[model samples]
Target: MTINHRAEAERHLSKASFMTGDGPNATPVNPAAADHYLRMAQVHATLATGQALVADASAYRAALASWRDIVAHFVAWGLSFAENDDEHGTYLRLAQRLDEAGLNIDNDIDKITPEFGKDPRGMWKPPTVRRAEWAAECAATNPPF
Candidate 1:
């Protein structure tokens, strides 16, 4: 990734970090997991932006893979911090962005959750569930969009 692209990704990830860690309505949950996932997302975003700037197909694929990993991390964190609606929705949007970018690791909307669904109230679950499901899906699927 170019320096500028990386910097841009850093900025976005920083935004995600703030959203995950500290907010007026932020959930008082696992700060460690929240920081981890948010930082992962930032890495993915940086990879994606860098690849886009260079127009490299291999880098693009790598970036997509990174995004998938970030989604998995988000799900795991969500489960551990079940009451953090802000973080839940934040990761949901990140997953959606990955999908829109055509990563399509596993097009399971359930994995993404109701932040984009019809539910007004957000929900949370255990990290293990999302971690196991993501591992199995990545192992079995061929990037199902």
Candidate 2:
């Protein structure tokens, strides 16, 4: 059975919009909801990329914009969270990756480390493990979108 990754991407994007309170007088941005949508977007983007590798130009074209938007939203959300969370290195790593991909993240990297330095708690106890585990899990699974 062939998967329609484009449709899946749209579905995720819709969910993301709703999560961000795009509709009339809706609830404010829910962090958990935004994270959920961001993950869904990533899964669909990966699926679309896989399809494109097999010469599925339609899937690639359809998902490209959604993927870009998803990344943008994810970055924005993460940066907002990171602004206060002294122990969250995940956002900085995410920002670096996005920057490396030429996404032009406006958040300054220099600010992240200084924020951590100022905070008494500093970095997370087991730095990098949780983020690595999450990334691995995401890479391994293609959830039903």
- Deviation in Å, model 1, residue 78 alpha carbon: 2.7
Native-vs-model 2 lDDT? Answer: 0.62
- Which whole-number lDDT from 0 to 100 does residue 41 have in model 1? 65
- Taking the tens digit of each residue's C-alpha lDDT, what string does model 1 give over 81-138? 5544466566556656666987543334344444444222223333445557668889
**69 Cα displacement, candidate 1 (Å):** 2.7
CA lDDT, every prediction?
Answer: 0.57, 0.62
lDDT for model 1, on a 0 to 1 scale? Answer: 0.57
Top-scoring candidate (lDDT): 2
Positional deviation of residue 65's Cα in model 2 after best superposition, in angstroms: 33
Candidate 1 wrongly placed segments (more than 4 Å): 1-67, 105-145
lDDT of 2 by residue, 30-88 (tens): 77888898788889888988877878677787798677666655544454444444434
